[model samples]
Target chain A: MSAQDEGRPIQSSTPDGAAAIGRHAIRTEALSKDFTLHLQGGLRIPVLRDVDLAVAPGECVALAGPSGAGKSTLMRCLYGNYGAGSGHVWVRHDGRDVDITNADAREVRAVRRDTLGYVSQFLRVIPRVPTQQIVAEPLMARGVPREDAMAHAAALLSRLNLPATLHGLPPATFSGGEQQRVNLARGFAPGYPVLLLDEPTASLDAANRDVVVALIAEAKRAGTAIIGIFHDTEVRDRVADRLYEVAPLQDAA
Target chain B: MSALLTAEGLHLHFGKVAALDDVALEIHPGEVVAIVGESGSGKTTLLRVLAGMMAPQAGQVLYAGEDVHAMGEAARRRLMRSDWGFVHQNPRDGLRLRVSAGGNVGERLMAAGARHYGDIRAEATEWLKRVEIDPARIDDMPLQFSGGMQQRLQIARTLVTRPKLVFMDEPTGGLDVSVQARLLDLIRALVAELGLAVLIVTHDIAAARLLAHRMLVMRRGQVVEQGLTDRVLDDPQHPYTQLLVSSVLAA
Candidate 1:
């Protein structure tokens, strides 16, 4: 699972192939991000400042705060969608140590394809592409045969309650809830080491929400590191092993 | 203590069954009291009575020592406009479905005699930000919002006028479990910031524990128990209260 060192303080272990060293699937040391307000005469606004966080294998860390507290911004930074202005976002990917904040495009793409799963708030699939194929792309990229990938895709979609007939159709016209389920299926299909979830069940009904809750539990049990922003407290309480409160920069002491 | 609102000897009947029976309570300014009960326990009926939305068969609801049921229609309407706010279980019930998200909040401001389009729009934007909604979505219709977003918009609509007393009936009901906590946190923060007297009717005891200073337990149209939120939840004297607390914890 992970190597141990006295100074690092080895707390526990996970299943095989979880993390490279320290069992820390994700770690951010003094991470900071800021935005230039061009409309306001180039004024700079601090989004996250001097923030330190860590997520171990087999644990879910929930980001809790009021909206506009930079929760989503931090998630984007962790997934390499946004760069960190300073500090580091160290992630364990496929037995390699990758720094997401300043990683080159090729490195970021490799880590994203091989070890990270992200379910953003909205679905963005190529137009007219079959939903099943889009969901299967992750596994296929990792060298799983097309047939095997499609089979896994079908299973995951079915588990998420997506109808069988709709698998071959594009998800562009699907309802919001349906689109969200499709997004979840694709993110989970890869069985990646880490998962970044943003309001994964935001539009889902109670029944579908329970399915997602179960999925999160399974991922944690499988030793996946999960960093999620759940505006829904119930799901956070059910899945999160710990919470990291992201205070607004103005409120930081 | 000078109670801001009080109810006495409240009794109501709907067809063959009693909706509320001999209910009495008092609310002070800058306090939050939560009413918890199962469906058909007459929690909503009691809230409606205290908010002056309905009159009981025999009882008196007083606001600032004045009789609510005895007020003239215009005066009652004015009282609701100026000093009272109501948050329905469904955001659609409390919000103007056809209006823009900002327009809904603006209407409340207009009712309270705010004019000048620039100032009203600015205030609306401010309130939306306070409720954790993106101010850039101010012009969007409430119909386009998600359930959680719509509920937050409904809150901004009700509180924009700075009402002295607010009545919320299952404010966080109909929302997914994950979205409920964020809304509750916003409501709790706003309630404390404004020091608005709130009487929240909910089935969620956890929400009560988070937001309310006092707790009221209702059963079969009567007050079964009442005390401070922590005390009543920690050591329940009534069997129904004990069951309710345990059920929430079990869930």
Candidate 2:
């Protein structure tokens, strides 16, 4: 059946059979985004084409593709950092459904704070914010108490094998792998049910890549659904239960 | 074989950390040598020292039978610009991201004061095609290409100048399996075609097996094992080398 003919707003209360299995996470249908590059004299280019994706509770889905294949763009669309031109992204929350694509800016911010988590390819940690404070940012945004959030962040950092000495220092000075662990800790800080990661292991070595994979498995055991874009197939093999490829963005006239 | 580059009793320190300790290496013309080490094992530091980017506290570096450290700055710079090509761990560091692919490939020639635009473009196109990138995209920015393509472009950039010695640091660090295979094949063919001597640093034993004529296994900034690739990788004697070989073999 056509998505429009269903007489619904392209929103699914739960992904197919996901709730029947005692969990519901993220669902999307015909989800697509088109970017307009405003070059000199106002020329526009359509970047992403129609793409469909879904993730179940505790499942890790990997997006694999070459550069300019719209993987990053799709991640931005799912995180609501960029508006989609057409489609719906539905997230199940406390026995109800919310269409993230249709939400207002404030509502989207709330969803991001309480229900969704995101990690981008290039981590932009705020300078001078201690590692604990950086990880606690998401929890603080959710109105959690500062002391409790800091404790939680500390525990996560230790579990991820970050040195205790790094707790009070800004993540900007940390190594690439350490910074990525901090980024993961921040994404998981608020107990969000759905997490999105973009190239989390791109700069890591073999040993550190193994560590990150173990963390993803830990997140899975906690029942957080994950969608990640990975450049390394070894990482994809270790973390993803399923894989999808993003086709190259079509050229515009 | 006559030695082209030699390091004797090299020592490097970063603060209190000993990155390389009494490391010795020798590279001969038309030979490919692979340095295999885990992270923090100082393979990169050794590369930098050989390339004259880093100074060692207690060592002598001989290039073409001359003491490289005793050379003046101008001579060293001349040697680097005219006789060496170094590829970094990340291709972006080796390339100018804002420039066109053709411009990147032709940069070394331009640096050596080649002013003919037609010759530069022709050489750039030839190298790009040799590296298997579409010539039509020669004008595209480095950022517009894929990671594998970018690495290939960087290889073209370095090799277009036809340097006698090339240094590559984990050239396949972040590439996919298929891309890595293709790139390794390209590098092998090009190195053979140019009769170029290579000093490659990599963590992947499989890559060393496929590319290097000789392999050196390092740990804690020391060469624990060194021999022909088959001899070293297949019959490693040191515990650390054994562990590394098993890990790669099992992987």
All DockQ scores: 0.01, 0.01
What is the C-alpha lDDT profile of model 2 across B26-139, one tens digit per residue? 888877899998999999888888888888999989999887878878888888777889988799999999999999988888987889999999989999999899999999
> For candidate 2, what is the lDDT?
0.78
> Which DockQ-derived CAPRI band holds candidate 1?
incorrect
Clash count for each candidate, listed in order shown: 4, 0
TM-score of each: 0.50, 0.50
Clashing pairs in 1: A231-B178, A232-B178, A232-B179, A233-B178
Give the Cα error of residue A153 in candidate 2, in Å: 64
Say which candidate scores most in lDDT.
1
Q: State the weakest 10-residue window (summed lDDT) of model 1 chain A.
A: A1-10
lDDT of 2 by residue, A1-253 (tens): 2211211131223345443423558776678765433222334445566677878889999987778888887787777665566787777665665666655433455577788889876556434458888798678767788899999999888877887889998887787878888887787678788899988888777876777788789889888999999888888998899988887765322
lDDT of 1 by residue, B1-251 (tens): 47899898999999977888788888888788899999999999999988888889999999999999999789999987899999998999988888999999999999999999999999999999998899999999999999999999989998999999999999989898868877886787688568799999999887887678677888888887775565467545456766687677633
lDDT (CA) for every model shown?
Answer: 0.84, 0.78
Off by over 4 Å in 1: A1-253
